[model samples]
Target: MATGWLCHELYMWHNTGNWAQVFPPGLTVQPGTHAENPETKRRFRNLVEVSGLLNHLVQISPRPATPDEIARVHTREHIAHIKALSDAGGGDASWLTPLGAGSYEIALLAAGGAIAAGEGVVSGEVTNAYALIRPPGHHAQPNLAMGFCLFSNAAVAIRHLQARLGVGRVATVDWDVHHGNGTQAIFYEDPTVLTISLHQENLYPPNSGSISENGTGRGLGFNLNIPLPPGSGAAAYRAAFERVVIPALHRFKPELIVVPSGFDASGVDPLGRMMLSSGAYRELTHLLLSAARELCGGRILMTHEGGYSEMYVPYCGVAVLEELSGVKTHVDDPWQPLMMAWGGQDLQPHQSLVIDKVAALVARIS
Candidate 1:
């Protein structure tokens, strides 16, 4: 079993409609352009092909998730609403989620792609997998699509593994720049799945992903949030993973590992303020891969979540896939020097203090 990659052309076409890159387009905003376009992701696919990385891994074709599979994670009402909107020639399904004609089908494909990746990992058809899906799903709540997400892809994939494959004790580590509020919400009170998110503090949707907002009820200590301050870079992220993420996974001892892979944390991303570079992403992937090997027999799956940098996301993803597949490439990140010079790559006393706070929570859960 080798590393598997799942993607579909339709994924690049799940349009999120035109909107101002920054709010209030009438004032100082560029002309309305589709906030979510296929360029960034399509370019990622192109990079992989041109760099010869695509030939090294098994490519898994995606199928649309059944309504039943979607219903396992999302409400039927929400599903109906989205389908109805798609039927009406497109509209905003919810907050940041937009759809065009037939997008409901494409969204299904994205969720299905995630499930297929999970299937490959669990079935031993692939040692591990990466589902490069779009209309990222970490921010999708059961009833609302808050962050350019229509369905909770990770949740749906997790549910499929649990219900169909009887796979148990799953851990999801979301490192998207914005909080993975929806993934956190879906498993908030479930102890079987341990949800950990390392994100920018108070960034998106506002008032979410606080460290104090750990799991509730039976899942009291199951969810962990490491909300790093803005400008946090590679060192800060490494510290958080070592102090919080790796330790939490070790303590939980999950059977399989899933990551909501988002490149929005990169220094050059338009939507985030963090300073993570391609090296940061590669190191993060290496750390998670190590933990997965130690705790779960190297069974790990990463489904693409959020990444907005059209020029740099491809390289970021290439770095991650290289580590995941154990494939080497000569393709270099052209902006590495500039990003390294952007500073914040080193750990700071203030960053250590923040990490220490989250590290303390590990003890509580342990």
Candidate 2:
């Protein structure tokens, strides 16, 4: 039950300059902390230490991904653009995605962290691992950086596993509240990788993650998007997994399972409109672990993604780590009781309809 953990002090140093959450401060807008700041990730690491869970986990050191490694998933121009911006002392990577000096190097480190975690699981160095790296990468694309992401960390890691480690049939289950557009696009036409994203419908990136946006060419039906309605909760998510996610994984039978884990789907996150609690995340982790055990030799690698609630992200992270490591701490999520009791925590008929549609797509995965 060895769970590999990766974090670097420099991860917190990737500066996203002072801007109101996702916007540059102006006369009309007040300057405040950016939504993707370091506090959430730093606090998550700290809580792991405070909860004594860090002691039970194996630490994995991360190296900066080589330009060639990043090129596996990103274009040379896009890579050069980020480096130039960082060299010029920081600028926006794309719409609303900003970075500061040395951010290019930090982004490389984040991608490397993801690769390290995947290597740990694939090499049997750890049963499963979680890389709590910063500057979330799910929203990044091959040529453009969007949301708060620079490099598509999960995509880079998956490419590394396939091209370098001789692994095949990798599946990514992204429950990040926002569409994993980048990861989806990277493997959209490739049948070897199954990309499943359970996100809020049309929340970010505008008009993306529709049920019809499955996959194209040979990859059709291999990509699944369960766009749960806003305010979806534990019941909706559980239904999606049992009816869509787990079934797809079983059909695909991936050699490794990658999770773009994000806590923004939690009840307290400012960016998302969902109502999931820490308990819900624990349940989801349990389900994924069971599926991995049966389908992928129990190899699961989770790379950190969008989660803005500094206060609550730590609890949600700990819950997942506890399940991953089979170690429980005395710390309890004080927000669970309230979040679980909130309205719309049960599965609505509308949510069921969405899940049913996505469930049908699972049959297409050969």
Candidate 3:
């Protein structure tokens, strides 16, 4: 089995219009650009192609998810609202989340790419797959679209797997710097899916992703949140995965594993303050791959979530694809050394304290 890479150029065309543009034209913000531009994702694809890894993977076509498939995770009102906005020439659907004309169709394709990738993995068509979709989905809620996300791509894909393929007990691990509020909300009361998010504390959507916000009702012991303090580096993240994520996955023993992979946690991301490096992403992917192999026969699907550093995101993505495909390239990340040399690259005592605190939450829920 080979890894599958899913992408389409239309995803890049789903424009976010323009942001505030630096508050006052050409002053404070220095002419603001769209936070959710296509360069980061497009560059990631280019890097994959340039590295030759794209040739080694299965290329999956991007399809539009059926309305029924999407409705399983999103409200009809929300879907209709998005479509109407697109028909009316586009506008902001929620806070900071913009939509362009025909964005509705592009969003469908993004979610569909995730579904296709998930299906490919669970059906033994691929050992693992990575869907490089756009309009990151972890921030999208059942009725609301925020944080540059439209529909809950990961949630929709997981629901599709359960309904269409009869897969059970999915584990979604989100390492997206920001809390996966939408995902956490969707499965907050459903015990079949275990939602785990590792993000920066008190960041994005402020006050979300708290450790105490574990699942409720039947899902009480199924949800877990690991909010690392800002400035956390490679060591801090590794510790969180080893202590919290790995242990939880082992205990859950999910039939399939899904990751909302995000690159914004890297040191250079403008929207994030963490200190992850490209190699750090590679190591995280390695850990997840190992866990998937052990607990689920290597049935894993990763959907792209967030990453804003246009220059660095490509390298980070390349590192992840390399691990997923078990391939190496002559092109190396020249910025890795500099990023790793930053102050927070090594784990600090305080960072460990935070991880320990979050890791301890698992026991209560377990």
Candidate 4:
């Protein structure tokens, strides 16, 4: 029942500058609104405040992830590039995913938190855990940070377990509404680590995750990508898990499960067209919990991914935390706002096609 929270002060140290606003913004009021640390802090604090499970949380103070630790999953050249960018000025404006002043410490803290979560799982300090890490990690590749991601946090954790803790079989499920191309690439040729990314296709990073981009060499079939179209709601995500994710895991039977948690799939979020609500996140967490209980010794580590709607993301995040910690917290309008969204702008025929296409694609895959 112990749930380790690999959180440090630097989780919110990353401050987005003006560049992200110009290219592709985040999920809040406008594109660049969610780019600020205060926005993430506001919503994240809401979830923690309501949950009352703060007692169960483990606070990992800020610290740097060593170059060797990073190299476990990322390419040395990529690391060098990011370091140069981080050091050149204060941010990385080229990709619109800039880092603010003091962001270097923040990135280290985020990376450290993920590694701490991995340790928690290995040492049996918790049945499962979630690292409320920031500077989302799914979009980061071995050498670069795209899509507001600075490091491949989940992939790095996997490498830590394999090299540092001697874990053999590891699996990561990324439900970020965008493809986890970086994670897949890190373990693309490694059979020991399995990555399952079920995302809304054609969203960001246009052509990243496709069914045909399965793993290569020894890692063949270890990487599974289920790309859902826009507007896919609770049903599609859950069905993908039951049909493809769970089945694959049940058959592969890994020792640990990790989720790159992202709430951008919520209906209110501007980055995505998915109709998933707070309730949907809870259900998805429940499904993962069930699978973990049945297969992977109930070990799960969810590192923060993406979720833009400041108002809505907190609610959805709280919902998932509630399911994970078995803590029932009551918050007002949490469920109402998202439910309201589905009925208002989400049901338009154009959006509905997105859901239908996702369903058809899943049918083809599973």
User: In candidate 4, what are the lDDT values of residues 1-366, reduced to their tens digit?
Assistant: 777766655576677765343354446534444343457545676567666757656554435678788878777887776677667666563465777766655676677778888788777878788788877788887777788887888888888888888788988889888899889888888878888887887677877887777788888778888777676777667667766777777777788998999888888777778778888888889998899999877889888888877778888877777788787766554565547455432334544444344334333221
Task: Tell me the whole-model lDDT of each prediction, alpha carbons only.
Answer: 0.88, 0.94, 0.89, 0.74
Regions of candidate 1 where Cα sits further than 4 Å from its true position: 22-30
Task: Please provide the root mean square deviation of candidate 4 (C-alpha atoms, Å).
Answer: 4.2
Evaluated at residue 143, the lDDT of candidate 2 is 96
Candidate 4 vs. true structure, TM-score = 0.87
Per-residue alpha-carbon lDDT of candidate 3 for residues 1-366, written as tens digits (9 for 90 to 100): 599999999999997876752122335455457868899999999999988998999998879998888899899999999999988999889887888999999999999999999989988889899999988899999999988999999999999999989998999999989999999999999989999999999798778998888899999978888888899999999999999998889888899999999999999898899989899999999999899889999888999999989999999999998898898888789888888888767889998987888777677444
Better of 1 and 2 by TM-score: 2
lDDT of 3 at 63: 90
TM-score for candidate 1: 0.97
lDDT per residue for candidate 2 within 117-199, as digits (tens), equals 89999999999999999778999999999998999999999999999899999999999999999999999999999999999
Instruction: Arrange candidates by lDDT, descending.
Output: 2, 3, 1, 4
Whose TM-score is greatest here? 2
Candidate 4 Cα outliers beyond 4 Å, as residue runs: 20-38, 58-62, 336-366
Q: Give the winner by lDDT.
A: 2
On lDDT, the stronger of 1 and 4 is: 1
TM-score of each: 0.97, 0.99, 0.96, 0.87
Tens-digit per-residue lDDT, 115-156, candidate 1: 999998999888889999987899999988777889999999
